[model samples]
Target: QDNAVPKQASGCVSCHSADGNPLVEGVPILSGQRSDYLEAALKAYREGRRTGGPADVMRFYTKELSDEDIKEISEWFAQN
Candidate 1:
């Protein structure tokens, strides 16, 4: 891991753009979304509140994130 990169930052850009737009179809666009909503959604995936299908990928990605990581990510996307 690079010392300068924020945790969880690299993982998102592949599917979700740096500006929070989803690169693929069927993926939600996170740009302009509420921070609280983003955080809650991430938390839901992390906590297994979402199930099956596309949610599986989210769960896998968010599982390693701490609460603060989620907050930072949510804020980043929300501002885009």
Candidate 2:
């Protein structure tokens, strides 16, 4: 791993951000969503109770996120 990348680089937004992966379709348009809801959904996905589609990719992603990170991403989407 490179020293320049932060430890939090495991986050989806770390690579799939607007400037990086804005082209991927059906990847939730996080912008303008409610923070609390987003946070709860992420938690659900992490716990395997909210499988998405047939593959449940969100579950894998959410599993890697900490509570603070989930809240931060949710809040970022909610505000911007």
Candidate 3:
């Protein structure tokens, strides 16, 4: 498969930055984080498993992400 970094991640590049560092305050940096951790967190956010604080915003953003989207994003950020 292509695995060339999904286009869906482009939208996240702004706030999270291309390297997973957040440009805005209170946002967590995803760079170098554990892939499993990032994947679980993204799944939690998409499934409404986490709430309050940043989870609210993430929930909105991840609501439309498919399983593959979450996997690609988590893997990409982890690599950074």
Clashes of each: 0, 0, 0
Runs in model 2 with CA error above 4 Å? 1-11, 14-22, 52-55
| Per-residue error (Å), model 3, residue 63 | 0.8
Pairwise TM-score winner, candidates 1 and 2: 1
Among the numbered candidates, top TM-score falls to 1
Cand. 1 Cα-lDDT = 0.82
Estimate every model's Cα lDDT from 0 to 1: 0.82, 0.64, 0.82
> Tens digit of lDDT per residue, candidate 1, span 1-80?
11233557678767876654678778888767899999999999999999999899989999999999999888877776
Q: 1-80, model 3: which lDDT tens digit per residue?
A: 22355587876766887665589887778778898998899899999999998889889999999989889898887876
Candidate 2 differs from the real structure by a C-alpha RMSD in angstroms, to one decimal, of 5.4
lDDT by residue (1-80, candidate 2, tens digit) is: 11232334345554345322344566666556688998888888888987647228777667778998888767666665
Q: Between the candidate structures 1 and 3, which one is better when assessed by TM-score? A: 1
Q: Which 10 successive residues of model 1 have the least lDDT summed? A: 1-10
Q: After TM-score superposition, what is the CA distance of residue 68 in candidate 3 from its true location, in Å? A: 0.9
Steric clash pairs (candidate 2): none
